[model samples]
Target: MNEIESYIPHFIVHGRSRIAQCECASCRAQTPFVTNAWSNQVRHSAQIQCDSVSREVLFERDAFKLHTQPSSPGDGEPLSAWQNNVNQSCINFLIVEDLSIEERLHATGVLLSRLSRDDLNESDASTPQSIGDELLTLAVSGVIRQRFSQMPSIDRYKRDYLRRLAKVHLRVTPDPIASLAFNLKLTELQVMSDGFLEDVLREIESSRQVEAFFGKHGHVWTNYFLHRCFHDVFPGAARNAYDVMFLDLCLDLFCLRSLCAFLADSDVELTEESVSALFSAWHRGGKECLGRDDHVDPLLVGYSLITRKDDRYGGCHER
Candidate 1:
C-alpha cells in the first residue's frame, strides 16, 4: 500500500506509541516527528471535512481541484452557467470557516472570475444586485477575518473588489448618500448629541482650530463633511433654504470669497429668479454634487460648465 493509504491515526490512550520505536540517532529526532504528527492531524481534519462536502456531485470532482474549464468559445457552457457554478462553490466554502487558505483562495478566485463589467455597474433590482458583493463581505468578514484583522495593505485586485462592493452597497441601501458618507470616514458626527449642528457651528465660530483643520483639507473634505451633516439633518429629502443658508455660513467661515465663488458657479445663478426656481436648482445641484468625485475642484467644474455652456449657447460667445 502507498504511504497515504497506509496512514493510521495516532492516539495516546495512556501516553504510549502503538508503533515500535527504534532507539537510533534518526529516531531520536523528536522535533521532526512531533511536527509531522501535528501536520498530519491538521490534514486529516481537513480531509474529513472535504469528504463530507465531496458527496455533492459538483464538489466531488472539483473540491480540491482548480477549475480549468474554458468559460466560453471552445466550451459549450455559457458564461452564466460558469458564473453560477463559481458562485455556488464560493458560497459553500464560505459557510465552512475552518477551510484551508487554499480553499478560501479557490473560492475567492472563482468569485472574481465570475464577475463581468456589467456586474460592477449600479442596478435597481430588489435582489442583492451582485453576488460578488455578498461573497466579498463574507470572505473578508468570515472566511479571512484573521488575515485582515491586523489591517494590512490590500493589493490592487482586492482594492478593486472592495470598491465594487462599496458601489453595490451604496446602490442597494435606502440612503446611498449616507452610505457613501460613512465609507469616506465622515461618520464622526453620527454619534454627536441632538444639538449637533449647533455645536459644530458654535465651535467653528468660536475657534481657529476648526478653521485651521478645514483650511488644511480644503473643499474636498469640507464638501464630504457638509454632505454628512446635511444627510443627518434631512435624511433623504431635498435641501431647502435653511440647508443652503447653513452651507453658505459654513463656507463663509472657511472663507467668504470661496462661498461667493460657490454661489456664482452653481446652477442657481444667484439672479433675481423666484424662490421656487432657486430652491429647485439648488436642491438638484446638491444631489448631483454628492454623486460627483470626492474633490470639489472649481477648475474641473468650470471645464464641465464650459462644455455645457457651449452646448446651451451653440458655440456662440454671446449670451
Candidate 2:
C-alpha cells in the first residue's frame, strides 16, 4: 500500500479512541456538561468506519456512584435523591407557573436566533430569502412546539402532529456541493484564529473526507440524540420543517456552539417579548423595518433552559 493508504487505518483507530474517551468521561460525570462537545465526535468516528463501543458501560457506572454519595445530615436524604423525588407533574407546574406560552416562545426564538447561520444574518440587509431563511425560521418554531408536547398538561398528540408537520415541509436532500463550499469557507475563517477552538475545528476539517457516511446517516444520528438531550429546552412552532432540518445539519459547527454559550450567559430576561418580535422580523426575512418597540436585549435563554433543567432535578418549585 502507498503511504497515504497505509495510514488510513491508524488514523481511524486514533479518532475512534479519542471519541470513546470523551464519551466515557461525559457519561461518568452524571451531568450534561460535555454532552454537546462530544456528540459530533461520535458521528465523525462513525464516518471513519469506526465501530461504536458498547454504551451500556457509560451510564451504569454513574448510577452506581449515585448511590454511594453520602446523605445530607439536615434532610436525611441522599444528596442526589432530589431527582428521584421530583415527578413529571411537579416539574411541569414549576416550569409553567411563572412563565406563559408567549414567554416560552420568546425564549425559544432567542435560541433560534443564536443558532441561525452567519451567512443568513449577514444577508438580512441585502438579499435574504435567496438563501435558506424561511427553512430555519419554521424549524425553530416546530422544535419548540414539539418540546411543549412532552409536558404533563399539554396534549402528547402534538408530538406526532409536529413531527409530521416538520417532515412535510422539510425535505433536506444531501447537498455535497453546498457542504463542500461551506467547509472550504470555514477553513479560511478558522485558519486565521488563534485559540483552542481553532485547533478542534482543524481536526474536524481534517476528518471531513471520511464523513461520506455522514451524508447517509447524519440526519438520523444527529437529530435523534439532539432532541433526546434537549427535550426540555425550548417551546413554539414555526412555519416550515426544512429550516429545522437545515439547522440540525449544522449542529456540530463551532460558531453555533459558541453563539449558544454566549446567549445563555447574557443577562436577558426570561419573559421578554421584544426578543420574539425581533425573531418575527428575522422570520419575515428582514424585509420589513424594525419599529421602536422591536428592540431586543441580549438573550439568556440558555441559562433559563439550564435553570429549568436543574429545577426539575432539585424537586420542582416556584422560582
Candidate 3:
C-alpha cells in the first residue's frame, strides 16, 4: 500500500488481501482499492464508540484525536485532549451552551417571528420562515453544544452557513441560533440540526430573488453556491455528511475565483493597506473565515487547488 493510503488504514484494512466488492458502477469501472479487516473493524467501532477502535487501528494515539469530522458542528472533538483549547473565545462567546427544549423553543420562536416581516416574498415562506417559532423552542429544550469545535472544512462550511442563517435572523431574535449546536442524539436530533440546514439552503436557492442574488454574487455566493453544490453535485444522503461539506469547498474555490475577479475589476477602490488589513483579519479566524465571508477569498494561504491538487494562488498579482 502507498504511504498515504497506509495512513488511512480504515480504507485498506490489510496490506492487500482484503476482499471488496466492486459493484458500484464507478468502482467497477475504475481501479479499485482492497478493503481490509480494519475497515470492517472501524465500521463496527463507529457503531459503538468512534475514537477508541479507530485510533487503535491507525495507531495515532491511545486516546482519540478527533480528526476531521465531515458533518460535525462546532465544539465536537473525538478526544477530550484535543478539545478545550482556548483559541476560540470570540467564537464561543457568540456560541451559547446547549439549552433545554424550552430555551430552544424560545430562541426558534424569536427567530421565526422576526423573519416574518412585511418585506418577505412568497418563497420566503418555504425557507427562512418555515422554521417556526415553535421549533426554536424545541431545539433549545433538548440541545447540548457539540463537544469539539475543530471540525473538517466540509462540516464547518455547513455549520458556518447555518450560523449565518441564525445571525441573519438574530435581528429578528437578537440571540442567534448559533454557529454551534448541542450534541443531540443522532437517532433523533439529526433531523433538527443537520436536516434543517439542508432544508433552508434548498428553499433559499429556489426563490426568485435568491437565485438572482446568487447570480449577481457569482460563485461562492453563499446560499447560491450552497444550493448548487448540494443539489447538483452532491445531493441528500451523500456518501456521508462530510460529502456535502467537500462539495461546498469545491464551490468555495469557485468563490475564491469570483473574489479575484471582483477585486481585479472593482469600481470601489481601497488602498493596499485596506486590502492587507482585510487579508489579515480574514486569516485570524483561520480557515473558518473562508467559508463564511462573501467579501473575502477562501484562499487565505495565498494558495489555490488545481485539478484537485493544491496550487498556490494562480491569479495575477497587481503591479
Candidate 4:
C-alpha cells in the first residue's frame, strides 16, 4: 500500500479512540498522534492526493474532538455530578443555571466555539428536530433572562458576539421549542431578528419531530413563552404593541387566553377587546400560519374554532 493509504486506518483508529476517552489529557494527546501520522505520511511527497488526504484526516480529527470533549472546569473547580452523568458536550449547558449572566455568556461562547459541522451532522442523524436542544435550553433559561435584562446595556462587541452565537446555534439546531425559547430570550437581549421568529414558526410547521417534542414539553414551553411575553415582550409600551401582535399569532388559544389573563392581572393596557381582535386576525390566516396540527394544543384548536364561529355570528362571548 502507498504511505498515505497505509496510514488511513491507523489515523481512523486513533481518532475514534481519542473520541471515546472522556479524560482531557488522554484525548488531547491522542489528537496529535493522528495529525503527526498524516504529516509523516505526506513528508516524502507533496503530491496533491497526499495533501488532500492529510487535510481530510485532520478535519475529521478536529471534528471528533469538538463533538466529544467536555468543557473543562475553571482552576480549582471540579466537574459537578450532573456534568459527569451527561454527554460531554452538554456539561457546560447543564451548569448554566448556576452561572451569572456574564459567566453564562462566557460558557455559551466556549460551547459554541467547540461545535463542529460533524456535531451538527451527528445531531441530525440522532434526532432531526431537537438537535442541540440541551444547549439551546441553557441559552433561554429563566436565569439567563433575568440576569441578561437586569444588567446594564451590553457593549457593541458583546452584543455582536451574542447575536452571532445565537444565530449560529439557531441555524445548526432545529429544535422548535428551543427556537421559540431562544428567540424570545434573545429578543429581550435586543439581539434577534424578526425573520428568525418567522423562521422558527416555519420550523415548527414543517418538522414532525418537533410535533413529538412539543407533545412532551408543551407545557414547559408555553410557560416560558408566557412569562417572557408578559414581563418583557408586552410591557404596555407603544412600541411593544407590534411584538404583542407577533407573539399572539405565534400562540394558540390556550396560551393566548393565559396571556390575556396575565395582562388583566397586571396593570397592562391590553384589553380583552384588543386580544380578541388579534385572535380574529390569527384565525383568518388559517392553519398554515397556526403551525402543524400536532404541535398546536388540541384543546386550543377546538376552542379557537368555536370562538371564531361565535365571533362571526356576533354571539356574546367572554373569552
Candidate 5:
C-alpha cells in the first residue's frame, strides 16, 4: 500500500473505519495531504464507499474543523452569515455534508425560509428573496463544477449545455411550484414534521395553476414507479401523490440525461437497448448502488470493467 493508504489502518477497527475520532500526530501531519490528493483522484468517479474509506477519514477531519469554527463573525445575523459562508464555501458545503444535490437544495431552502422570518432593515441588500436567489444560483453552479471537475474539454461542452438546461428547468420551469410552496410554507399548516405526507398534501391541495402543471406532467415514469412502490402501503386518499412524485422524477431525469450526454461524449457507446437494460436491472432488483465489501451489483461491475480499462472515463475500480 502507498503512504496514503497506510493511514487508512489507523482509522480502521475490526474491519470498520471511523474518521471523526482519529487524532494521532501522524494523522494531524498527513491527513490534509491525503484528502486533497484523494479529492482530485475521486472527482467524477462512481466508486463505492469502500474505495473512499481512506479519503473519508481525511474529509471528516476537515468537516470537523469547519463545524468547530463559527459559521460567521459576531454579527449575530444568521441569514447574512450563512449567505457569506455559502457564497465562499458552497462546493465545500455540499462535499462536507455528503448530501445529494436535491437534499442540499431542500436543506438550503428550508434554512432560507426559517431565517427569512428575521426582521431586516429596509436598507439591507440581503433581502430574503435576493439572498435566496443567490443561494440557489450558487448551489447549482457548485454542483456542476464538482460533478464535471475532471471531464475533458470535449465532454465539458455537454457539461456546459447541461448547466444551462439545469438552470432553466430548476429555476424557470418550476416557478409556479416554487411560488405555491412558498405560500404554503408561510401558512405553517404542517400535519407532520418528519414524513413526506404533509409535503404531498401541500402539492395536492395547492392552487389551480400548480395542480394543472402537475396534472400535465403526471404521466412520467417516476410517477409510475412511486405509485407501484407506495400505493398499497398508503392506499386511501393518496391518488394525488403523483403531483409530488413526477416532479421528483423530472429532476432525476435531468440528472440521467446529463450523465448519458457525458458518457456518450467520452466514447462510452450507449444505445436505447443498453440504457433500457441497465434501468431494467435497477427496476427489477433495486437502485441502491452503494458500496458493500463483499458484493457489488452486476451492472456497476460490468460498467467499471469496461471503464477501468480506459483512462477516458473517470475513476472506476476493479473489486
Candidate 6:
C-alpha cells in the first residue's frame, strides 16, 4: 500500500461502519465525495484491480467465525466482508424503493441482489431471512402499503419517511434543497454546514401542502430516502438468501417499528393521473416533458413481483 492508498477511505464522508474499504472510485479514479459538509470537506480516494475474468482471491490464514453468535443475521459477519455482501445489499434494496427503475437496474451490480423462494425456503428456516432479501420480499409483497392506511395521524409516516428519505439523497446543494422545501413545505435547515442533512430532516409544516408538493418532488424524496438508508442499517451478519440478504429491512422495519411510526412513515404515495404522468415521463426517458406531477406513495419493495405492490394504493393512470 502507498501513502495515497492510506488516505482513500478518509474521503468517504457519510457512511457509518457500513462504509466499505475498497478505495475504487475515491482513490484511483479521483471521484469526488463529501466527508463533512463545508469547510472540512475535500476530495479524496484508492484503487483496486477488477478482474475482467472475475476471479475470487482468498487467503485462509485466520479463523474468523469459528465461535460467535450475536443473535440475528443482521448482526453482521465476523471480519472485513462487510462491503460486498452488506453495503451493496443495502444499496440495492434502497434503489428499488428510491431511484428510477432504470437507475435501479443500471446499478444492479452495486445493489439489487435478489433471492428466490427456493432460496428462502432452504433448509435454514430456523434463522430469520436476509434483511436485503426480506426487504425485496416486502417490496414484492406490497406489505409496506399497510402503513399508509387511514391512520388517525398523518405525520407518523411523514416524518419517518422524510427523515430516512433525506439521508439517502445526499443532497447538499441549495437549489435541490430549496426545491425540496418548496415542494414538501418542509423546513430546510442546514443540518450539515454545506447544505448536507443528517441529524435533522428539514421539513415544512403544512399537511395540506404535501399533496401538491409530492406531485412535483417524488424523485427528490426518493433520493433523500435512499441516501438516508445508508445510515439506517449497518453491517451485521451475512445473510443466506435474498429475503434476508442485507439487513436492509431493518431500516424500513426501523421506520415502522411502532404504530405511530408506521403511521408517520407511509410509502411515497402517488395517484392515478400522477403515475400516468410519471410512467409517460419514464417511457420518454426525460426526452419530452409531462405534467410536473411526480409522486410515489410515501413507500417501500423486492421478493415476488406479486407481493411487491401495496393494496392501499391501487389506482394509476395508464401510459
Best by TM-score: 6
Between candidates 3 and 5, the lDDT winner: 5
Which model is ahead, 1 or 2, in terms of lDDT? 1
Q: How close is candidate 6 to the true structure, as a TM-score?
A: 0.27
lDDT of 6 by residue, 1-319 (tens): 1111111221122321222433322224432232211121211321112110000110111101122212222222322333334554555544454333222322221233333323543244322336556555655464433322222332333343343333222111124543353324222321333323222222222222332434344443233233333322233333333333222332222221121111122332333222222222222222122111122321122111111122311221111
Q: Which scores better on lDDT, 2 or 6? A: 6
lDDT of each: 0.27, 0.25, 0.26, 0.30, 0.29, 0.28
Cα lDDT of model 1 by residue, 81-112, tens digit: 33233334433433343433223333333343
**Model 6 regions more than 4 Å off:** 1-79, 97-129, 147-206, 230-319
Best by lDDT: 4
| lDDT of model 4 at position 289 | 33
Q: Give candidate 5 regions above 4 Å deviation.
A: 1-82, 85-99, 116-260, 265-319
State the lDDT of candidate 3 residue by residue for 1-319, as single tens digits: 2111112223123312322332322234433432222211111111101112211222221112122212212222221211111111111211224332112212322332334344645333343323332343333343311211111223334334334322111011111231111111111222456667545333322334323322443211222222222122222222222222333344443332322222223222322222222222222232253443342433221111212111111111111
- 10 residues in a row with least lDDT, candidate 2: 36-45
- List runs of model 4 lying over 4 Å from the truth: 1-119, 122-143, 150-273, 282-319
Model 6 Cα displacement at 63 (Å)? 40
Candidate 3 error regions (>4 Å): 1-77, 80-239, 267-319
Q: RMSD, each candidate, Å?
A: 26.6, 22.8, 23.4, 22.8, 23.8, 17.7
Off by over 4 Å in 2: 1-23, 27-210, 221-225, 228-230, 235-251, 254-319
